[model samples]
Structures are given as structure tokens and as C-alpha cells.
Target: MKRPKTKSLVVYGTIAAILLMFWISWAGGIVPQVWQVNALLQDDPMLQEYPYKFRAVLLASGVATMTRPYDMEVAPFDFLQVIEPDLAGKAPNDPAMVAALKRLRAHERRAARVAVSHTAADGVEWVLDRAWYHKHGIKLPPKTLVY
Candidate 1:
């Protein structure tokens, strides 16, 4: 029987280590215990006011026609629906425009309000905007979605 070479052993060990690191990162993602809150929000830092922001305000601000209540605690996310677009390397409003439109229509009754935001960083410019809900044939509902 022939013995395995030292170089071959070293190469195989290095590859195994690399793959393990990747698996650790992927599998541990999303669990709060293994994830950071700031890490998630900071991932998208745009300036435009979010539609959910408006929706939450309406829901918690004493609902225009209801008597003031003391138990309303607004959730962290303002809207039940959020449409985030990633226009990273391709042209703006590419084939993904249709998907964007569909996202807009998903929770139509929630809020006819759409918010757009854009941020520029590291020599890259980003633009995000949502059309008016009513204009899109969608209406804003009272309670926002939280998940």
C-alpha cells in the first residue's frame, strides 16, 4: 500500500476548512441569538420616509375617528407591506420593474401610500421610490403588518 502525500493532505484540509466557514455563516443567519439588530437595519439606509411609517402613525395616532386609547403600542415596522428593490449592477427599472409593481399591489388595502428613498455610498448611488397607493389603484388600510 502507498502512503498519502503531505501536500495532498494539506490541500484537502484547507478546502474543508473553507467550506466549513461558509456553512457556518449561512446556517447561523437570521436567528436573533446569532444575528445583530443593527446589522439588519443598517443593511438598507435610505432617506425617504417609508410608507409603513405613515401607516403606523395613522394606526397609533388615535385613528382619526376613534376616542384616544392608552394601550396602543406601535410596532417597530410601520407598514404591513414593504417593497425593497436592489438595483445594484444593472440599469434602473430593468425587467424587475414588474415584480416591483406586484409588490406595490400586494397589500393594496393597507395603504395607498408609497415611499421612495435613495442613498449613495462607496461611489454607488441608489434610488428607491414608491408610487402613491391610491394612484396605483391601491388603498391604505388602517393596521400595518408586522413580521
Candidate 2:
């Protein structure tokens, strides 16, 4: 059989390289958030108080994995508004939920600050999408969960 032409091989190689870069950028952006969220879910006393409830909130909020595109600023607590009715009778001010929200917000912020310590850090996936915010003339960090 005849071997593939050099031109064809180069084209295929270039495509693969581009795909790899995109994959890296996407994963880099999401992995850190996932790591931070999971870590909080596992270790935060408030979150652990009602693991199932918190997990349900995370899933329902579409922030469970924290991997969705442009999901850097999403947190489990952000969905509190949408889910207030469902939880109004139960955990509106549940100590665990409130504490968890505060802790998670702080944790996310610190992670973002660390991940984007330098200007060049913007090239990768940023927690809180800090790079995107900066590009849009928003100099402040992401908003936090309100009690």
C-alpha cells in the first residue's frame, strides 16, 4: 500500500496539536474549580452536616462538577435564589447551609487569586474566569454569596 503523503501527515499533525491545546485550556480552567469544590464539599463542616442536601443543591444548580463552560463564578450557594422556595421551609437560614456558603465563597476566591497570580496566567483556564473579567474591563473579583 502507498504511504500517506507528507502534506496530509502535516495537516493531520497540526489539527491534533490545535485540539490538544484546546483540551488543555478547557481542562485547566475547569479542573481547579472542581478540585476546590470537591475539597470544600468533603471537608467543610457545614457542607458535611447535610451532605445530601448540599449535593442536591450543587446538582440542581448545575455547579456540582463545576466543569461547565464559563462556570468559573458559579457556586452551590448562587442557586439559593432559584431554590429558595424548595428550601424555604427547611434551610432558609440553616446553620450548615449558611456557613457552607460563606466558606465556599472564601475558598473559591483564594483559589482564583492563587491561580492567576501573574498576568501570563490568563492564558489558561481561570477560576472565577478572572481573565475574562479583566478582558471586559471588570477589575473586581467575582461576587460572593450573600447570607
Candidate 3:
């Protein structure tokens, strides 16, 4: 059999490279968005307390994931609100929900302060503080969580 032409090989290689790049970009972008939404939803105290709402939010997230184009920019919370507006807003007029929200906010504030204080001086202290926060599930502020 005759060997393939150089032109054909170049065309095939270019197509393969394009496909690989697309796949890499799609996976890299979408996976983090999904994880971010999942984390935010799971860590929400109100969602945990309300099973139906949790299911609804998860379903909406899944739909958003499906409909979202590869590598498209999307704010996870914004997509969430498009599906269920209430999920993004303040809790309903329930005392327990309000208390839970307050507690979560307080925890977030404390974690932020601790992270700021430790990270201000040395890298070693920052690492140690991060490890402690993770071990304790302190849920450090979003910026601190990145390292």
C-alpha cells in the first residue's frame, strides 16, 4: 500500500490537536464549576436542613451542567438562581434557619480572621493554619481555601 501523503497527515494531526485542546479546556473548566456548585450547595446549612430543596438544587445544577457549552463562562450561583431563586436569597421566616445562617456566617468570619492573621507573616504558618483548618473542617474563607 502507498504511504499516506504529508498533507493528509498534517490535516489529521491538526484536527486531533484541536480536539484534544477542546477536551482539555472543557474538562478543566466544567469540573471546577461543578465542584464549586456542589461544595457551595452541600455546605449550605439551610439546604442540609431541607431535603426537597436540596434535591431540587441538585437537579437544577445537573441541568445547568448539561446545557452549559464547553468552556463557557458561568457563575455557579447565578445558574443556581436561574433554577431556584430562593436558594440564593435569605432563608425563610424560620427561626432555626436564621440561627443556622448566623452560625455559618460567624464560622466563616472566624476562619477568615484566623487565615488572615496566620498568612500575614510566614508561609510556614499559613500552611500549618490551613492544615489545621482542613483537619477541623473549619471551612476557611474562599480566598484562603485556594492556598
Candidate 4:
């Protein structure tokens, strides 16, 4: 009887340990990264006015691993719904928020262009440049010219 009880205890302990590790990894790593991204976005003058929207976007982007400027082209509204459901519906009607969103989009586009230019020979740059071309309706020039 004691042996059976010991075996059950060991199994329960193993399951508990797994759960604890998952919680720790998420809370210690991902949560802090999300907060750091939010702080950075909040500090930006262009984004300061739209604190909630910025937070929503940052959290979603962090989860999606959307760290690159080109990755930000994903619509903020989708994330806003998850982060701040109450404000998501009203965002379209708010002129200030709309303007801020536009500014953020433009900034991301410029950043993506700069990143592509700086890393011209890299694989990442190749992908980013393709995206940039598609977004701006520009044709990709010859590979020789790209490098």
C-alpha cells in the first residue's frame, strides 16, 4: 500500500513541476519583454497619445515575434480587440487615434526601408525589400542592382 501511495505522489509532483516551469517561463521571460516593449512605445512622442493602442500592438507583436519594422504592417485593430476590447470599436471614430495609427504605419515603413538598405546583402533584407516593394507598388530591380 505504501509503495502505491509513493508512486502516486511522484506522478503528481512531476505534473506540478511541469506546470510550475511553464508558468515561470511565461511570467519571467515573455511578460517582462511585453512590458519593456510597451514602455518603449509609450516613450515615443508619436505614440504617446495612443497609449492603449500602442500597448495592445506591442503585446500582440511580442506574442507573434513581430520585432522587425516590416512585421508591424499587420493591422493594429486585430490586436486591439484582444488587448482592449472596449476601445477597439471606438478606435475608428477617434481622429487622434487614427492620426497616430497613420504616423506609426509611416514610421514602420521608413524603418523597414532603412533596415533593408542597411542589410542589403542579408537574407532578411531580401525578404524585407520584397515586402517594401509590394507595399509601395514598386517593382524589384535586378539582383545585381539590389546588392
Cα lDDT, all candidates: 0.32, 0.44, 0.38, 0.44
Summing lDDT over every window of 10 consecutive residues in candidate 2, give the lowest-scoring window: 53-62
lDDT (10s digit) by residue, model 4, range 38-133: 455445665445323323122232131224222323444443343344545666658755764566566554433322332111211212223434
In TM-score terms, candidate 4 sits at: 0.28
Sorted on lDDT, best first, the list reads 4, 2, 3, 1
lDDT of 3 by residue, 1-147 (tens): 335687788889999999998998785533443344445545666545532222111122223221120012322233223334455564444464455445444543333332223212111110122333354344444542334
TM-score of 1: 0.20
lDDT of 1 by residue, 1-112 (tens): 2356777888899999899989978864333311222232234333123332222111111121111111134211212222342533333345664454444344332222
TM-score of each: 0.20, 0.29, 0.23, 0.28
Query: How far in Å is the alpha carbon of 57 misplaced in model 2?
Result: 23
In model 2, which runs have C-alpha deviations exceeding 4 angstroms?
A: 1-75, 78-89, 122-147
Which residue window of length 10 is worst by lDDT in model 1? 62-71
Model 2 reaches what TM-score against the true structure?
Answer: 0.29
Q: Count clashing residue pairs per candidate.
A: 12, 1, 0, 0
TM-score-better candidate, 2 vs 4? 2
Off by over 4 Å in 3: 5-10, 19-93, 107-147
Model 4: residues >4 Å from true position, as ranges? 1-18, 23-31, 55-64, 67-104, 107-147
Candidate 3 residue pairs in backbone clash: none
